[model samples]
Target: MADRNTPNRPRQRIIERGIELLLALCGSISLLTTLGILGVLVWDSVAFFQDVSILDFLTDTQWTPLFADKHFGILPLLSGTFLTTLIALLVALPLGLLIACYLSEYVRPAVRNVLKPLLELLAAIPTIVYGYFALTFVTPLLQHLIPGLAGFNALSPGLVMGFMLLPLVSSLSEDAMQAVPSGLREGAAALGATRMQTAWRVIIPAAFSGVMVSVILAISRAIGETMIVAVAAGQQPRLTLNPLVPVETITTYIVQVSQGDVAQGSLEYNTIFAVGLSLFLLAFGLNTVGYFLNRRYREHYD
Candidate 1:
């Protein structure tokens, strides 16, 4: 018995060590990948900044770096990105919250189990399909109602992107609401609060941090979205707030420059890296803010 147990212990220890090493490698892969991306962005962006001043890049309103007459102002792309993100959030937040409240507070477990998966299936649809759907279906339909809306405009794509992001917001929000203790609901009922009142006043507030984290994540997703904006929203980089007109986003510009026409190692080619770096910064900022907010407001239940 002693000989058998001693041999098994060494074999088990070897297997455990192998598993530990594999897990450590898996964890480091993501961090290493992130560092690699940051290094590339910084390296290329340095070359791009040599010819184009950072001041001009920030202050200039034009973005025609592809043309013979060059401009590198990022405001147009920034505006378009923010515009679409705002429109998407407007469409997603209210509807998502309503759906979440319904799922979390009103529905039975059986109904919620069935409905949540159906709702989340929307996220599985390819983004390219959504882009084409916006162009072929939603844009023409909107043109009939909105007299002057362009064929390739921000409104159509923004709306489609909003719907694309709906599942994310609703699913995360529902999870947050579900995390609230059942005792809270019972107490609210005891105090004569109706379902709507309890959800609006208690559950939502309790889950605010989680909901906000979901929203921030959705915003980052909206900003980083490429296909729908590229296919539906035209490539015209104009710094305007009107949703009826065509505009270009940072991701679209990266896609445009990456299409093989632009020479590698050239200023135009390097612009993508610079734009990508800016996008990285923006996303990082939002995620950092979300992290702090979550830490600040997160509730710990016994």
Candidate 2:
């Protein structure tokens, strides 16, 4: 209460205010950036919809915007996006859950420290490198087994994207499992539950909310991935579920149109923004689901 008598008290208050202002600005940056992106997408999408009806955009089966006979139906792109994401989930989920269980329950702390980082390094590899690896290596390996697999198909990229997302799922799930109280484990042991049974029945159910959130976020990430799909998943936008055939996703379409060949103000140019908005909405929905799941079912322990 007598700090006003201190010579440096006023200076300390000013410094504290300055630090608070700086931290607020840093936190606001993400919010501002997200608003900026949404604004741009809505602005450009308005123009695109002026020329192309919303009904056609939703109902059109083909997406041949660059061709002489132009079409803007987004179904093909959506199908392709769905197919690749499905493949990636199928590949990542079980393997990631197994890896998480092993790391959280079985591995020694020292070994987990070493192994987790090594596993996470897969995520650090540039996505373009994964793209090229899928195109050059995985595709070739698959061709030897599948009789009529296209040179550029969804399977290879989907598989590579799965590997890339493995670390994210496993890491998040392992952290959630680790957060469960040690007393739970001890109680299970006292009840004569085997280690495997305890981990499966007790720990997993307790951490289910976190694990579910991680899976949702991973699905969003797989949907939004770009380069690997761009390189290995072909540019042909076809409404097909055959992973052996070439197809293009919403993200692949955005990359294709953003390559500077399309004029900046043309309908083709505006299509990118429209599709960008769709992708944004998809991701936002997935994130919303994850957030709600985290909030609603999250366990509280003192």
Candidate 3:
């Protein structure tokens, strides 16, 4: 017995050490990937700024870098990006919260088990498929109701992008609501509050930080979305608040320029990195806000 136990202890220790090393390696890979992306964006953007001033890039309204007369204004793209993101959030936020509240606070365990996967299936579809569906089906449907709608515009793609991110928001928010203590619900019930009342007053308030995180993540995803905007929305960047007209987002512009015929090291090529840097910064700022919000408002369960 002593010989057998001694041998097994050494083998188990070796296996545990190997598992720890594998986990550490996986963690380091993510950190290294993030660092690599930041390094490339900053390096290329620095080179771009040597020729085109940062002020013009931020202030200029035009984005035609490939034409004989190059205009490197980035505001048009930013405007389109904001317009579409705002449109998407308007469609998503209410729907996502409603779905989350229902799933977390109302549904029976068996029913929830059956329904959650079906709802999440929306996320499994390829994004390019959503782009085509918006372009072919949704846009045509919208045009029928509003005859002035353009063939390529912000509305259809924004709507599709909103639905695409719905599952993510719902799932995260549901988890947060469900994490709230059952004791809170019981106390609300003792005060004669109904389930609906308890959910809105106690559960949602307790989970507000988590709900905000889900919303911020959804916003970031909408801003960075490429294919849906590229295929459905036109490549023309216009600084307009109207969603019916053709517009281009930063992600779409990046895709467009990447596919175009342009020489390497030219201003046209350099603009890609500059736009990428701006996009990175935008997403970073949003996520940073989310982090602080979560930290500031998070409730301790114990």
Candidate 4:
């Protein structure tokens, strides 16, 4: 037994060291991949800025890069993206929280088992499918309510995008609420607070970080969403604040240009990187703001 154990010990040590090395290698690969993407975007964006002045790119009112004479304004795309994202958040935020509150405070565990999966199934649906559904079903439904609604407008896509994000917000918010110490809920109840009052005052405040995380993630997802907005919101990048207008988002423009419509190595092609970098910055800024806001209201519920 001693002889066998001695041989096995050295072999096991070698295996353990090999596994550690493999994991380190895997982590390095992931970091390298991220750096590679950043490098490409920065390199191309620098080259693009050389041709299109940063001022023109930032302040240009028109974005007709594919035309004979180009206008490289980013306002149109940014506005569209913001419009759709804000609209989606307006729709999703309240509904998702209410759903989370109900699921956390009201529903039985058995019912949650049945309903949560069903809700999550929405997240599994392909974006293209949601886009088609928005185009065909949601748009028609909205036209009946709003006069002069465009055939392809921001509203339909925004509404569908909200629905697509609902599950994410609900799941995250519920998990956060669940993580709140049971003692807090019990203390509120012991003080004669009703179930609703306990969930509202006790659990929600304690789970503020989680709810904010869900909102930030939902906003990020909404901002990055492509096919649904592309299909439901028309491919025209108009600088209008109106949600009823047909506008093109940053992601839609990227997709449109990537379809071999623009020449390679041209200023237009370079704009894709610039636009993507801008988007990365936008999402980063949003997360940063949310972080500060969370910190402001965050409490130590103990």
The sequence of per-residue lDDT tens digits that candidate 4 reaches over residues 1-302 is 89869979988999999999999999899779868888888999999999889998999989999889889999999999999999999988999999999999999999998988999999999999999999999999999999999999999999999999999999999999988888898899999999999988889989998899899999999999999999999999989999998999999999999999789998899999999989988887988988886776675443
The candidates, ranked best first by TM-score, are 1, 2, 4, 3
| Model 3 per-residue lDDT tens digits across residues 151-189 | 999999999999999898999999999998899999999
Candidate 4 whole-model C-alpha lDDT, 0 to 1: 0.92
Stretches > 4 Å off in candidate 2: 1-4, 299-302
Q: Count the backbone clashes (under 3 Å) in each candidate.
A: 0, 0, 0, 0
Query: Which residue pairs in candidate 2 collide?
Result: none
Residue 289 in model 2: lDDT: 85
What's the CA error at residue 43 for candidate 1, in Å? 1.0
- Candidate 3 minimal-lDDT segment of 10 residues: 293-302
Candidate 1 clashing pairs, residues 3+ apart or interchain = none
Model 1: how far is 171 from its true place, Å?
0.5
My TM-score estimates for the predictions, one after another, are 0.96, 0.95, 0.93, 0.93
Cα lDDT tens digits for candidate 2, 1-302: 57656978888999999999999999999999999999999999999999999999999998999999999999999999999999999989999989999999999999999999999999899999999999999999999999999999999999999999999999999999999999999999999999999999999888988899889989999999999999999999999989999999999999998889999999999999999999999999999988887777774422
Local error of candidate 1 at 264, Å? 0.8
Off by over 4 Å in 1: 299-302
lDDT of 4 at 285: 90
Q: Candidates 2 and 4: which is better by TM-score?
A: 2
